[model samples]
Target: MHLPGYPFESRWFTHDALRLHYLDEGDGAPVLMLHGNPSWSYLWRRLVLALRGEHRCIAPDHLGMGLSDKPAAGRHPFTLAARVDDLDALTGHLITERAAPENGWTLVMHDWGGPIGMAWAARHPGRVSRLVVLNTAAFPDPHGPRVRPALRLPLWLLRETRLGERLFLRHHAFARLATLPPFGLRDRLPPDVRAAFLAPDDGREHRLAVQRFVHDIPLGPGDPSWPLLVRAGETVAAFADRPVLIGWGLRDPVFDPLMLREWRRRLPHAQVHAFPGAGHYVLEDAHDSLVPAITAFLRR
Candidate 1:
């Protein structure tokens, strides 16, 4: 299903016996967009339309997140490593099929996309030409002293207990709040756009990935994903010379000023833009300024 203003056709690729959904638009240098939990390629629709005239835009819905096939319990493991591998497989196939640009590619990432995309970028540094980071963290820095005090309770509920599964999969609480205003968005999302993000995970089975994503957060050395996240941090930090654009929303409660500061600390050369009026969804909040900045960056 397509959003009203986003008229691009949906494309599919096979990975690990599952049919993954993605969008391939326009041509030239490739702009690979990876989304976070409870969101999909639909998150990058505006950016895709803005740059598709001169750039190839590839946005994928992590399996079970968008129109991609959602496998049942025994079918797949929704871990951080699995998400990165999905991206690797998708890009590998695109390169083989001549869909990827001949040269290195640019990445546009947000939320969980930050770590997932960075994980892939970490492994394939030579193929990364540039990066556009929006309200996401590639490393596990949230546990530091800068973390919001109130954030702990919700995280504990969502990450360490059955409440997360019940709330996300059964009640659809996350999707409902995410697609509405007051969270990632400053204003209420358009009906079609909200629906597009929610439609793919309308069922418990399809929503499993959403729950698992929260559960996968590596809070400490004992966490399952901690080692991988540390590796990703090292890899991302090594690409300091690559052109990087960090667009952030200062109003975001989750990835707030501290996260931006962390990014600045890591990628000292990145061009940073912080939007005070925006929230977690920087694209929706500051796309007017963001699109132009990204286009100019690509041209450079």
Candidate 2:
């Protein structure tokens, strides 16, 4: 498929035997864009084109999400922690080569990307300069409706059942995002792009990450990511003292206005723009307005 406006690039970090796929373009300060579940670096296509001219935009396809390699369960554990580690490794590699300064890079997060990217930022508080959040969450459960009820099933069955995998991927929420009115790209993405999103799972035997991602929801005690999320919450609170911009789509079924309200409560000083007409894919729905707002925010 032709990913016009958004090209592709690759980077390898030997420390973790990790081959990271990212978009490295433009110049000046660095802006790292991280996407949420079911989507890949492709999510940031418009954002990349908008920001690259003024900043070095780096958007990576999380290990199993986009164009990155998808190792089997025994070979790789696709947990939230593992995802954070990958981000750390990639950033460390980039810094060593002086691709970006350790303290000036901005973070752009969406969906599950909030936790993964914020976890890394919490670990290295000094490295993150600004935060641009888009309908994502970083703190503990906000008492909102969980998006994936099907994920609550048994890990073995959820991962192993071909039917289950297909169902989850083709769920209404995501499927709608990919084929919605304004920004649906079902027709635009080639078979490979679509396959890249689903091919990581070869039945239950290789879907450890997807299973773990579902199981790791830090709703309460005993959650594996609770501690990290707590620390991330604190980091977000502290980071709020810096510049923060939130662009939201109110019509989103998941991460709706409630999520935006939560962010507003936490960061009262943040610049927020809410789109009541748009859906979960705020970038796509409001690309024309969002890109300019983001650019202006960065320039300020």
Candidate 3:
């Protein structure tokens, strides 16, 4: 992906027959940046560039996202548990390649990434040195981490009404809306920046991850990903003692103050910074402040 300010080499981690895309830049302490749905490793491009000089920045685009191979519905599990497993397998391969730094890894997560990264950390608790959370959630908040009312019906329609393929696959509604104003971002996207975000999601099949990510949100115990989500919640709750930093965008419609409060309840000792004007794309809107804060946090 040759874009402005993201001059990094592409690396691949093989899983079965598919090629998972990742970025390995610079050296020293390893920082694994995991992105959520509708976004890719491209979401962490700024953070990677900022810290690549002093840190080994490894950012992977999850299967069906970014440059990774997007297998058809039945071929890929497309569940939360599978996403976590994919991340673990990719990192394990990296470890074998001597890509891991001497120090334990640092995890930076956003959106769906909170669950994936934390689940991996749960698998190897001692290996994660620190955690830096953006606007994201590890567990479902049963009571009130409520998505905005305006978005509730449309999301329900997308999930239950079988309307996902039409909107996501055909019109690219979710993908297009994510980078623009009042949808996922607080700032207006420049043409090039918006284009970069939309590049991987070109054809109908390419939008599967975006569609499945929404459909996979486990609402109850009967859901396919419920067991793993429970474990992720339990594991994430136990990390209060680990050094943690949170930079939240107060304007996020889905992950609002309630989500932040939930995170605080789980990790009471975490250092948190809330950006009132920033939206779901906190990394993009609050980059100036968040990037430096993350840089300093990692150094410490």
Candidate 4:
């Protein structure tokens, strides 16, 4: 779909027999931006526009999300490991296999990107020069005091029950709700922006990834993605000395202040800027302030 103000050239690479889409803009040191579930590379449009003039901004749509080809669950597992491996393959196709710079790519991530990008960074810690962590997590911390019971009950319903499928797949409630009050832009999100985010998952087949993502949250040791996430979380601390920036929205109910505190604890040297009123999609609410701050951070 033509994202109204986002007009970057689209690039595609084949992985697991499906066409994965990404944005490879400009020419210089790479700035790899990874997005979370339900959101795609489009989440980084403003950041990409800000940095593409001086850096190689690479943002990929995780298999089932964004403009990428969405295959059946049988064809693509939609697990965290699968998502991370897709990133590994994309890196090989874009940077590693192509004789790109040895290291110095800035890893920019949000939401599920936390685990996916951190998994990649864990595999090749020496290659990443910096990290720009938005409201995301590489590890599952159940002990956080802010883990609200109010949000947990419904999330469990979404993950374990068929009601979620009816709500998300049949009614497209997740997409509709994401664009509303707490999850997305604080103000009424532009109609075009909402359409662009919702367009890719309009069909039942297209919505499979969204449903699977909701189901993939690794809550415990038995979960399939648990080990990988644990490893990724451990790996997050390896880059403590590297330049890091944490931009967060204090109002995010899922990844709340506790997550930010964990990040600060893990990366004590990292710079953090938290917005009190911004929701999960903090960039939409604080882009004017954040983009410039992030831009300066990148340039420095």
Candidate 5:
């Protein structure tokens, strides 16, 4: 879908005092799309355009990202649990008197959305009819033994230290880097499209969620989000018996081949499409193929 053609009107749901911006379109069974850090519901713009004709596409911006109200750390608890609660509240509000009596939503998640969506799914398995895993992780198992463990130190530094604050909040590393090659796209997004991605977290106040999302990465057992991850992982396993689709970007440095292997091991029956040339933003790189596969999965 083209950026200029992203024509859906903005919708909002109030959670406590905060308003979350979302898109609720189309008319059939529900398809809930959750995005990750440094990005917002805009990440799913293309998919939303593709599936809205046949599916009730509901995509929401987490409290601080996208057109949603951006708050500082003091205003909101920027934790994994908080995210789950927000999503729960939003979906519960939408599904009431609307969703079909028997059918539940097909959960599509990427990046941090994986854990947040899975945690909620663990609590309300009956609400999820199908599962779609993008280039992301929901399981509790932390990345790394040797190479990954060593890598954690730098990540921690980036999350905890002043340097991290400077780079992420002040410098806007994720906003600056994600629209570029390797981390975001194998091929760069067009200037306007790239601008759309960066527009949400364009300044320091907008950067709070990006910085907090990095800080909230549960690196070990002691991390606050670790237990949440454990529960989320069980949900991922439970969905293995249900229809699951794994669309992976092979060149993703974060959720790389090792990550895909673990997912395959757990959900052997899943329909997977691994894109060789794609990076972290698999949808952008592999849209031609992944979109059709996802539409077919929803159809089935």
Candidate 6:
């Protein structure tokens, strides 16, 4: 049975027995779409449908996020750098043996996906043909308030307390989505679709990814991902010659217009479009316009 609006084949690559889930579609240059916290590849469903016919669209569910194996801390390191490694392993598998690089590649990043995906791009600057940024940041801090209070808990408590894991992954994350303006999406997502987003973690062990995402905020130099994010920011600043397009949701509670302004300042040549009514999920709010705009940007 096909998952409507997200009709694609799932492919997995084992990184130390933990299978990671990813979507591979179409037959042209690869367009890698990396999703952020709380949402899985589900966030890119509409965009994949729009672009797959012309370009190969690969969207992955990071280790513990989507259909991928939800291993505990003992099984996997759910840190920001590990996520970047997962992306690298998956992309290398796709390009090295499976497909040949033609037009190079375009990277589409959102939320935490911004840092994880851009980190990989920064490593292989020559392979990055273009970038499409959506309501995400690769730089440090950006001076935003901490939204996920549940993550501030001590790491040991997060792992030992089973109820804490469930509350954060299922209840807290999903509840926030309901509050976003409807934008005609209320009826489109059925019960199962919602469950799929939250289903990876029913037990304490399965909740490691969500917990680590919170704990790995990297606010300062001591944080593991700080150096990688700093490098990514520097790369974005240097890659001003690359064609970049930024679609930002001004009303986003988490990543506000301030972050978008920083991106513009970094990539002064980027074409930016701001959606006032949309929140964090700008793609959901402005997919009709965003899809065409992204398609045109890539086509050029």
Full candidate order by TM-score, most accurate first: 4, 3, 1, 5, 6, 2
lDDT tens readout by residue for model 1, 1-300:
556667889899999899999999998989999899778888898899999999999999898788888888778888899989998999999999855754679989999998898889888888988999999988878457343567788888887688776898899898788766677788887777787778778778778888888888777788788888888888888778889999998988778898899899899999998898888888887889988998889999
lDDT of 6 by residue, 51-113 (tens): 888899989999988778988676787888889899888888887867747348899999888
Report, for every candidate in turn, its global Cα lDDT versus the true structure: 0.85, 0.72, 0.87, 0.87, 0.85, 0.77
Deviation in angstroms for 186 in model 2? 14
Per-candidate TM equals: 0.95, 0.82, 0.95, 0.96, 0.94, 0.86
Candidate 4 residues lying further than 4 Å off, grouped into runs, are: 96-99, 142-148
Residues 1-300, candidate 5: write the lDDT tens digits. Answer: 334546888888888889999999898988999999778888888899999999999999999998999987799989999999999888878867455333578999998889998999987888788889998998754454333764567687787688888988788886788779977789988888887788777678788988888888886677899889878887787888889999999988788888898888888999999999999999899999999999989988
Candidate 3 least-lDDT 10 residues:
141-150
**Deviation from truth (RMSD, Å), model 4:** 1.6
Model 3 misplacement above 4 A: 101-103, 142-151
Per-residue lDDT over 7-83 for candidate 3, one digit per residue giving the tens place of the 0 to 100 score: 77889888978889999998888899999989998898899989999989999999999999999989898989889
Model 2 segments beyond 4 Å from truth? 144-212
Model 2 residue 36 CA deviation in Å: 1.1
Model 3 residue 16 CA deviation (Å) reads 1.4
RMSD of each: 1.7, 4.3, 1.7, 1.6, 2.1, 3.9
Clashes of 6: 0
Cα deviation of 84, candidate 5, in Å: 0.3
Candidate with maximal lDDT: 3
What TM-score does prediction 3 earn?
0.95
Residue 295, candidate 6: how far off, in angstroms? Answer: 0.9
Candidate 6 stretches greater than 4 Å from native = 144-166, 169-196, 202-204
Error of 5 at 10 (Å): 0.7
lDDT of 2: 0.72
Supply the global lDDT for candidate 6.
0.77
